[model samples]
Target: MSLPMLRASRALSGADMHAESHAGAYADSCSSAGRVVARGAFARFATTLALTGALFASLVASPAVDAKTAQPKPVLDASAVATPDRYAADAAQQMFAAGGNAVDAAVAIAFTLAVTYPDAGNIGGGGFMTVYMDGKPYFLDYREKAPQSATRDMYLDDKGNVIKGMSLVGHRAVAVPGTVDGMWEAQKRFGKLKWKQVLAPAIKYATDGFPVEPWLQKRREFAAQNFGGKTNFDAYFSNLKAGVVFRQPELAQTLTRIASDGGREFYEGQTADLIARQMYGHGLLTKSDLVQYKAVWRQPVTASWNGYQIVTAPPPSSGGIGLIQLLKMKADLKPQFDGVELNSEPYIHLVSQIEDRVFADRQQYMGDPDSYRVPVDKLIDDAYLAKRVEDITPDEVPGAVPVKPGLGDSMPEKAQTTHFSVVDKWGNAVSNTYTLNGPFGSGVVVDGGGFVLNDEMDDFEIKAGVANQFGVTSGDVNTIAPGRRPLSSMAPTILTKDGKVSLVIGTPGGSRIFTSIFQVMTNLYDFNMPPADALAAMRFHHQLLPQKTIYFEPYHPIDGELAEQLKTRGYTLQGQTFNGDVQMIRIDGTTPQPAADPRGVGVGRVIQ
Candidate 1:
């Protein structure tokens, strides 16, 4: 069947909702990739939504956030891309210059990171992609999946106590990756440039070598401190340092093969063999596991607030749901914030309060829908949100009121992840958030493939009701299971005004991804700050557990009087600047204003 027809067929059959047994046999050949819009498909979908009007509003928009106001000055009308590293962004622009669309640029960007920013970027890790084409959205979940050998209590010891590093520090921590398949699917179905051309830039960098910046050097130092004596770390990163040229000749060879043979080479051919062989004695991965891995095309979760539509990656990622819940609660309680200063004690307290409560709900309910039913519908339900607001005792110190999660349950560390935003002149935009799970990722580089493996296994709930290293509490919903995708806080989001793409944003801060993205959006759309200011603004975060403690970025604007007020209200404050780096692009009219967050060494620019 043709790509769109295939998508329609799967959508109709409901088979695309989750993976089925024996699916690996035909998934790659038929359903794993390709959702290419058959010429008129997008138009049909758009018209259908327009015709349905308010009936589709629930699916398309939420009414909590205010509408975006008009920009005061004219902005550039051009394609733009941003990544946590400069070279990756340059590679994305190169793809755009080669006549690639946003999907192509994004694919190129993702691969380039694997070469240039080896700390977080990888062939072994996985992530989520939020794509917008002709004002419609598509979610591609390339997030890592557990191997067939994985079990729910694997992280627990014989005595049933959680093992501290079992899930975070070795070959066994690796999950079957889906990034290659995900990018391939995007390019095959929606890319405007040749796959080979898209892979060329990354291959060139990997083979020819690229200079390590101070940030990369710092990352190398940190990895050395933690994983110094390990064979895997020494092999791939021992020689890495600032000003030194870093090259991945083996990775270059691998990319060359992938560029010529397609991503199948990585999943089913020599590359897969290399990964399996290297991980054999230390982990459970096998060539069969690689063959069975598939990247699913999901539907983005959307919420309407402030006259604009917010579209983000859905579950297995609690980021979007938590975002929607927090914003909805904030909007529901707007009457209380009227005339209050943005970062004033009252305003800060309110946002923190919302974060605490929403995170509580997330810990109880959100997880991989294929493994468990994540009551997303009720979590974002209008009535339920209103009740959550009513339960909030805003004036009292937060912990004193004992705000608990409402009915229905949900569902660390400096994130060793990278995010990039790309918008093409054709009005196609993609926000991709991916990771290695830890800096250098289990510190295990695939033997001959020259790529680090992800420790995403640690992302699962090793101990029920306890918070993981990233300060995210978990339950059965997030427990590990064979073939199940683990929960992630990667919120790659796209915003639309009326019906056109307005903003694309994402970040990499483990549990802080959602809150960082949330703050940036509100700063731009709600508070009307420019893209730079929006991203550079000081940020604060509060997860539900370890109640009453609010973490803020260093020298955060809230201090003195505001800090005093927060303290008086029973909130404990802690500050740190390394929350997460947010890369964002504000698309107003003709130009896409891209902002690389200053918190990290990212760079942003428009591709002419």
Candidate 2:
């Protein structure tokens, strides 16, 4: 009989049999060598019969399955990595294949990105790393610190007015880098591979060159146009083009030195001399600043939310407090969202309102904990957040002027950042978000280092209450101070369920980082959407200062009716070209399902 007819015949014959009976029959068919030849035929027949029964049962049980049920089953028994670039993902997979744990893969990915994705990934920039290992959470704060010469009003003029572009492009804009030290510290503490092994892929890419993708090409063109002839930027990046091999011999040498001498090479060795020399006359950083820069291990900001344990970046990053507060407020107001469809008019309005409140609190209360007292515990207190959101109404939107910081205490770090998530077979996970603050940060490449320095000085509040390039305003708590880390929005987060890593996720979008993460979490837990759909879902952002305006992604435009409904409720709907690039992995029963944001040229790989 034909295959279809055979399947149909089995389906009919097994119509009255229980699924257990089919399983028993299949086992019986494989019970002896005499039945070996018939194994294939019996197996096929049993599988067909089982599937037909399952389909019929499902159809009869629920005619209209929700998105959660309709989604494909999670990939089983595999490790995964999700990153903003294909090459970085491949590098991470190589480490995994070589018997590396999550930390090793993470360290490998970080270094590789410095070579393949230089716009944000950098040895000269710094960011946060959240790691879950040995049933514990750890946060590494290698965020760039202000130079010792940095002062509160350094970016201001004789007239006390803020100078435009002073803090965005030049040697003066660069902060002391900590990425090399951060990676080294993480590897030393948790990695299973040798430091040289972790950095091999990056050195290979830098030495052998990698293909210039469209995103890197665009960044190079932009740098050339705006920062041409400014410094070594033009000398190095001016010639790179798309679809060509872009090699950085100087960078390869620097990476090799770093691999050989360890992270100290960048902070105290010849690399430090090169950086100090590059900034000597025109900038604030000195070799002393580089030498003093140290990546700190801080306790991760953690909370329990809806049965999942949240582990994320602590102070210096407003992300952890912001995320916890948002989640808390959402939970407190859960009753108001009953019957509202996800991403509907009411849903967007409610979420935006909650976000605005959090942003308000962030502006007033968040800062580098070492330099200023950030009341993290008080900021995320359920009672404080309750009071912060108690005034919200479904129909009326609050004006920006009226939204003051709930507790007077005060932060954007930049959207031009990159994030990656990794998971290994042993269940350890890492969510890392690093940045240069702006594209090709500071637009100042080290003369011999061939790496971009961060424009993170712009992240500090150059002038309190004044909006920065990303339109996020902050207060005095975030003002610059010597050796202080700027308040950051980079929240690399991990979530655990029942003591196992459930989610490893993070993204790059200046002021929108935490909100983007919050929304994704809600999508996964609240809406029960699969990882892929949850990531691809439309995203909107509100920073409270943009005042009554809700920024939605143009790529995922709001429905006409929903937009009109939101407008009728006093919201100014604005479309931003991009919201965020979220790289995440969802672990379901020890299997990982990786999802890369569709908005960028990223890849999500499942490693067998």
Candidate 2 minimal-lDDT segment of 10 residues: 22-31
CA displacement after TM-score superposition, residue 34 of candidate 1 (Å): 39
- Candidate lDDT scores, in order, read 0.74, 0.77
Q: Which candidate's lDDT is highest? A: 2
Q: In candidate 2, which residue pairs clash?
A: 364-410, 365-410, 366-410, 414-510, 415-510
lDDT of 2 by residue, 1-608 (tens): 22233224533322212211100000000011112333353444445445555543332222122335333333248779998787788777767665567887888788888877877778888999999987789999999999999999999999999998889888999999988899889989987656666776675565446777777778778866766567557666655667877665556556656665677878887779889999999999999999999999999998888999999989899988899999999998888888888888888888888888898888877788886767777787878888887887776555734777787531322216899999877778899999888877888877756778889999999996788768987687788889989989999999998878999999999988999999999999999999989988888888887688888897698758888988887888988867899999999887799999998888999998
**TM-score of each model, in listed order:** 0.85, 0.85
Instruction: Give one digit per residue, the lDDT tens place, for model 1 in 1-608.
Output: 22334324422211111111000000110000011322143234233323433432231122211247331232337788878777777777666555566887788788888888787877778999999986688999999999999988888889999887778878888899888888888878887555666776675565446777787778778876776565466656666777776655556545655665677778987778888898888897788999999889988898888888989988899988988887788888888877877777788888877887788777777788787777777888989999888755457567776666787432310007889999888778999998888887777776556677888998988777767768787677788888889899999999888778888899999988988888887788678999999888878888877888888876355688778988988888887646888898888677789998888888888887
